[model samples]
Target: MPNPLDPSLATLIERHTGPVKQLRPTEHGRGSDLTALAETEAGAVFVKAMRDRGRAGGRRDSLLREIAVAPHLGGLAPALLWGEADSGWVVGGWEAAEGRPVDLRPGSTDLPAVVDVVRRVGELPLPEVAEDWPEQRWDRFVAPGEEDLFAGRALLYTDWHPHNFLLGPAGCWLVDWSWPTRGAAFISPALLVVELVAAGHQPAAAQGLLADCPAWSGAPAAAVDAFAAAHALMCRSAADRRPQQPWLAAVADAAECWAAHRAEG
Candidate 1:
């Protein structure tokens, strides 16, 4: 049977002018439903058509929300060219974000750069998101539910995986914005640290950089924990939803560690 949840590509083209050429399938953890290419003469665009879980009401709303906020977050990440709410399509002409995907494997070259980027990202002004995931409520979603923990808020891109970014000509650019939320106390950096540790490096190695992070430098440890949990949850959820994804196993494992570590502390 045809998948009832599959996105309708025709619906996207119908909204735009000129013929749309469907480009190569972009690789992502949740199966390749994202379409890329410019219109006959309308500049390059990346269309994130809602499919499967993304079609669920909340996910659809988040995609639309990202479209609205992209213009403000553009310089900090990838620039968004055009987008439509109902169609789940956002066009972005690609830009460069330094370094390759974060490889936790021992002696990986990208680790240092990843650490730097993490700190920088924290410092950037929270993007122009129409809705901000509340600071208090954000903990429930990103935190591990521990007591005596408090977290400050920052705009966070849930998926900061290396592959989601590129080190192209205009400097580093983070492409996907399907998942973003207001800062949870510690969930954002905490989760990233867990990913680094799970990848085989000592969390202490990056601790200095993380501690000195200008973006969230003064954020409480609990906040870090919350961000970590949220990030891990995202990876784990993606793995559960898209088993065939090559990165799921490792990413999920890393995310799980983030969750586990916070649970312990």
Candidate 2:
């Protein structure tokens, strides 16, 4: 297939990875303009790029944030090899992850690895660059005077889609740090609970999966309740605005179910 990147970005990437033998596009998703696995003389590398224009302007910031945090990720995620911006495009190359998305549904063996990785992520030292990036995505939806329930200094992988957790021969790897945030330790596993519910697990069972994660196990009931409620509101609003995206609606339903479970408890 033809190169999916801008000419200038292709040239820059080529300089680092050598001639691109093939560029197989992956799920670029809504946050990226280009996402491909490139086979090159240097070996395989995953590339994510975005055009610095129109609505992509926010995406450009996300790319920059990912680059900043990549170095601090230790082995929890792929290592950033190279990143550049040229001719209206921003690009990043990382050591390609050889893995498949984890399954979060009930009875999946990947659940153990998922719990381990989420715990490790919470243990990662908060990078100085992210000290000011509080977890506020749920702020508007949070009940008034309850926003402090979400505050903390731990770095959070807020996007908890199962696709973000890749299970490979080596171990589980978390990818797509485009929206990393500093927040309460419980937030990451809590978000993962939402994903588990979306994957067909009952709200209680989903929360059970994370029982090994200290952040989840130790979280106060009031804090979890507040987060579940706020996240349900956020998901519902997103689903309403993007009616064509059925997955958003599914997640919204899951969030509501989880929130109700919390309320009942």
Candidate 3:
């Protein structure tokens, strides 16, 4: 029942989430701490072990951020049960999403559902971002004017891949809120498009999904191209940082393809 990775956390959860049933390793995003799937008396929750180094002053209360934003986007994501900023173990109820990692592959029915979720996410109101939170840059490889399209005080999950979105009982529920960022406008959707392309979705399909986005109607194509380029650079940087990360490399390749396609038009 207790996770060998963090025995102390198992003990803590017994007190917080009731009896523990099982613990298993789960998918995790880079630039964060170790994570796992944990089941307890309360329900299933994601466990993220925080690292001491890196930015945000050691995790910077991610669970707190999720707690703040979850209520607002409750239907869009799972419910947060409890967490500790110092320990970096945030727990939330798990929902069964219809899609899986490979579901992002071509011809996967999950594509339409993913597109729908991305559209819905675009419509969700931005959560209030703390002024002290680290600011996300928009002008990375993209032009400067493209930056303001997504800037706001809203809380954003930043990571918007089909992997992060689970097709649960209610609908698609987003997971891994560890990298909460301010401003929910262009960043998440931009990430989603890049992810869709990376997951083997056709270029036209991915673009159509983005084009259909109501918020992006008046958005500059150059901005999406810039974001796509920037996302590629970021992925490559991440791959470089984690040389063994195959997923990052695949995503980088996809980003390149999307960038080239955008260049043609």
Cα lDDT of all candidates, in order?
A: 0.55, 0.88, 0.62
Model 1 misplaced regions, further than 4 Å: 1-11, 14-17, 29-32, 51-56, 86-106, 127-130, 135-151, 222-265
- Best model number under lDDT: 2
Q: What digit string (tens of lDDT, one per residue) describes model 3 on residues 75-177?
A: 7766555555445354333332344442667777766777676667667765545444544555465566665645565455577665676775465666666
Ranking by TM-score: 2, 3, 1
Per-residue CA lDDT of model 2 for 1-265, tens digit only, reads 2566567878877978888989988874556888889998778999998887745437888998898899998799999999987778788999998889888888999989988998899789999999967878888887687999999988989887788888999899999999888989999999889999999999889888888888889999999999999999999999999999999999999999999999999
Clashes of 1: 29
lDDT of 1 by residue, 36-67 (tens): 44334554455555443445445555566566
Q: Candidate 3 at residue 158, lDDT? A: 73
Instruction: Sort the predicted structures by lDDT, highest score first.
Output: 2, 3, 1
Worst 10 residues of 2 by lDDT: 50-59
- Provide the lDDT at 26 for model 3: 64
Q: Between 1 and 3, whose TM-score is larger? A: 3
For each candidate, what TM-score against the reference? 0.67, 0.94, 0.76
Q: On lDDT, who's better, 1 or 2?
A: 2
Worst 10 residues of 1 by lDDT: 90-99
Q: Candidate 3, overall lDDT? A: 0.62
- Report the number of clashing residue pairs per model: 29, 0, 4
